[model samples]
Target: MSDKTSEAKVHFRSNAKVHEVDLRIREANVRLCQLCLWRNRKGIGFHIAPSSSSLPVICMVESNSPASAGGLKICDAILAVNNKNISEANYQQATTIIKTALNTKGRVDLLVVEQKFYKELKKNDISMISSSAKILVTPHSMPADFFNFPKHQPRTCDIHVNQDNKTFGFEVVSGDDNIGIYIQEVAPDSAASNAGLRKSDRIIEINGTYIEQDSNMNYQHYLWIAQASVYVDIGDDKSKLEATKLFEFVLYENPLHDNARLNLAILHFNPSHVHALETCAIVGLQMNHPTEAFIDLNQVLHFQPSSAPLLANRSVIQQFLDDNRNQSC
Candidate 1:
C-alpha cells in the first residue's frame, strides 16, 4: 500500500509539472501586441463582457480602431494589460486597467488568448464558453419549430429607480419606415442610463404590449425567412437558384434580437450600473450562465461593497461553481 501511494503521488506531481509547462507555453504563444491611443481622446474601441472565472472576453472590436489595428479580435480573452493581471478582473476593472495603461504609457501591451484557441477550449466544456468565447446571440443549432412562430416575443425589463424622478432617461425615435421604436439617447446619471439603455436599442415591447408598426410585415419575418432559406437544399438546381436569391434578400439585413443583444449590451457596459448588473446577473443565472452571473455579482460588489444580499448571492454562485467544478472532475 505504501509503495502504491508513493507512485500515485509521484504521478500527480508529474502531471502538475506538465500542466504548468503547457500553461507557460500557451502564454508565450499568445501574441504580445501593442497599441497607442490618445489620452482621453478616443478609446481603444472595443467592448468586453465578463467571464465566469477567467479573463473578460472581447465582445466587439470596432473597425479601424486602435484595438483592431493591434490585432484584437472578438472572443479574445484579455489575459493582461501592461503586465497587470486582468485574468480575474470584471468588465469594468478590465476596461479601467486598459484605460489607465493607455493614459500613463500612451501605449498598452495586451496578452490575449486568440479566438481560435478560445473556441478549442469551448469545445471541451460548456463552462469554458464563459472564459473562452463571447456569448453568441444565436444558437448554433436552429430548431425546426422556430420557423412556425411568426415572431419572437419582445423582452421587457423592469428596473427599480431609487431617485426622485420616475422617468427612465431615454429618448426614442420611430425606426425606419416606422417599424419599431429605437432608443435615440440615454441621459447620463438617469434611471434609463442606470438601467443599461443604449442609443439605437430597438424597443420591441414596453410593459407587455408589442410596439405596433405601420408596416404590415414584421421585419423579423424577413430575417427568419432568410435564415431558414439557407437549409433549403432540395437537391435540384432550380431550387438551389431560388434559395440563393432568397438568401440575397435577407443577407446583411437581419434585425437584431432585442433580448440577446440587450443582455449582452447591458452586461458589457462600463461604470457598472448596479441595477442593470443585478438584473443581468439574474438573467444569466436563469439562462444557466453562472459565469456571467458571477461576473455581474462581482462588479456589483465593487460598487456596493457592504451589501449583504450581494455578498450572499455571490457566495451562492461561488458554491454552485465549486459544485460544478467538482462534478466535472
Candidate 2:
C-alpha cells in the first residue's frame, strides 16, 4: 500500500530564467501595495511645540509629510492649536495636539503670533493633509459649541477599592513614563475584587496620596515594612525598623512577626502589589511549597480572567508537581 501511494505522487518543476521569475514576484508584490494604499492614505498627521524657553507665548508648528497641505508655514509661532493654551505645552502635551488635529477631520485652526513678522491671527485655517488627493474628505464641524477636548481631562478612580484589611485591599506600583501605580490583578472572594478592582487599571493615587517614586528609599523595602507593621500598634518608626530588621537579619529573627504575616496575606490578596508578591512567592517556593506561587497567579486571574499568561502559570504549577513526583522515584 505504501509503494502504491508513493508511485501515485507527482511533482513538477519550472525551468524559467531568474529574471523572468523575479519579474513575476515583483508583479505579485505590487498588487499587495495597491490594495493597502487606501489604509496608508487614511493615516496622516503632524505635531507642534513651544518655540522658546524665554518666551512663554512663543510656539512652533511642524508639518508632517504627505499631510502637509493644511497651509501652515514652517516656524509659524502658534499661540494656540485647536483652542488649547500653548504656554502649557510640553513633551507629553504633543500627543494632545496630534489627537485634536486628527479628531477634527483635516481642519486645524491655529491662533498664531508670528514672531519674525509680528502678526497675530485667529482661526488660521490649515488643512491637516494634502488637498491634492482625490480621497473623500470628512468635515469636522463639531456640536454647535463644544467645550475643550475631552481626552485631556485628568483621570480619577484608577485605584481599585475594597472594604477592610482582611476583606478589602488595593495596591500601588511603578509605572512607565509617569509616577503612578498600576493595578495588575485582584482576587475573587477577597475585599479588593468585591470593591471593584479590575484589571489594566493605572492607579494615580491611594487614599488621596500620590504614588511617587521615592528615589531615597527602595519601594520593596518599604513594602516589607508596611506589611510587617499592619497589625502592630507600635510606633510607626519602630514597627518599620523591626520589619526591616526581621528580613535583613533573616537567620537571627528565628520567628517572623505575626503582623508581618498578616500584611503578607493582604499583599497576596492584591496582585497589583508586584514587588511584595514576587518576594513572598520566591521565598515560599524555595522553602518547598510551590503552591504559594500558584496562589499569586490565582490572584492575577481574579482581575484578568481571559489572560493567556495566567493559563500558562497553571501549567508551571503542574510542572512543579511533576518534579515532586519524579523526585520520589
Please name the candidate that would achieve the greatest TM-score relative to the true structure. 1
Error of 1 at 316 (Å): 62
| Candidate 1 pairs with clashing backbones | 52-291
Per-residue error (Å), model 1, residue 309: 69
* 142-208: candidate 2 lDDT, tens digit per residue: 2221213233244553323212342235443344333434443455555555654533344444445
Task: Please list the C-alpha lDDT of all candidates, in the order they appear.
Answer: 0.58, 0.41
Query: How much does candidate 2 score in TM-score?
Result: 0.22
Model 2 alpha-carbon drift over 4 Å, by segment: 1-173, 177-179, 212-222, 233-329
Residue-by-residue lDDT tens digits, candidate 1, 1-329: 99999999999998786565456436433555666663323666567865555568776664335565465655567766765556678877887888787778777777666644654433332222223322212122223433342343444545444324544566554443446655545678887767755444566555444655623244444333432233232324454454444444443353353333333344244435788888878877877788889998898888899999999999999999999999999
Supply the TM-score for candidate 1.
0.31
The global Cα lDDT (0 to 1) of model 2 is 0.41
Q: After superposition, how far is residue 262 of candidate 2 from its true place, in Å?
A: 20
